[model samples]
Target: MPKGEGKVLAQNRKASHDYIILDTIEAGMVLTGTEIKSVRKAKINLKDGYASIRNGEVFLQNVHISPFEQGNIFNHDPLRTRKLLLHKKQIKYLIEETKTTGVTLVPLRVYLKNGVAKVLIGLAKGKKSYDKRDALKQKDMKREIDRAMKER
Candidate 1:
């Protein structure tokens, strides 16, 4: 199966608008019991999530996994940083690629594959304001074309 073929729990819609994705990789997440439960219920947010490599490991930051409703004191923190599991070779490649200016690792989507949570991270470069405008214009034009074709 493809990297993000399973049921998606949360998607970072703004990530694509703000950055141009160059490549993507799938990595497993280390989640606590409660956190996994919340994720399974689709109570997760990836709006401000980003990945950073630290000491040769990658950590996901700013992603919010809401506390499980039925959980008591054992519920995990909603914004706790989580570790991402990736191969050493993949990590090395990410390190080299991210060393370039303006390049970053952003979590694009989170999904469950084979009952395990996986994150699809993208290697992206920031998009300028004008680039965003151009993309919007292109989308509008495509929409108009599709509308015209549909009416014919």
Candidate 2:
């Protein structure tokens, strides 16, 4: 990775398998001091996390940032809902877009950029059972093709 492209702290790999991501947006996170320290160490889980528009603002829910071990008394709540900082226009657009049926917001990954914590949020539509199966089949086929080419 190059400079300015910070390290990824955590990712929700299952999001891609379950939803067809239509678009992605990067937003900043409001973190406490210790929480940011924990995030730097990659002590976070995005597997069960999601984003929502609440009270005209965006918030992240279910994402867990483990408490800083050294800061026993000042540790932040591991699973507290964190506010996402986005422009008013962006928030309004997401609110309108998510109103359509079958569309929702999900957190794809968390990373540190320029010493700030940011989240990559995706606008996604859920995949059906058959769609998932078809994707799995295609992936398997692609893997086989790559393997065969490697041996040649």
- Which predicted model would earn the best TM-score? 1
Best by lDDT: 1
Clashes of each: 0, 0
Give lDDT: candidate 1, residue 48.
87
lDDT of each: 0.95, 0.92
Quality of model 2 by C-alpha lDDT: 0.92
TM-score of each: 0.97, 0.95
By how many angstroms RMSD does model 1 differ from the true structure?
1.2
**Residue 20 local lDDT, model 1:** 100
Please report, as a residue range, the 10-residue window in candidate 1 with the lowest summed lDDT: 1-10
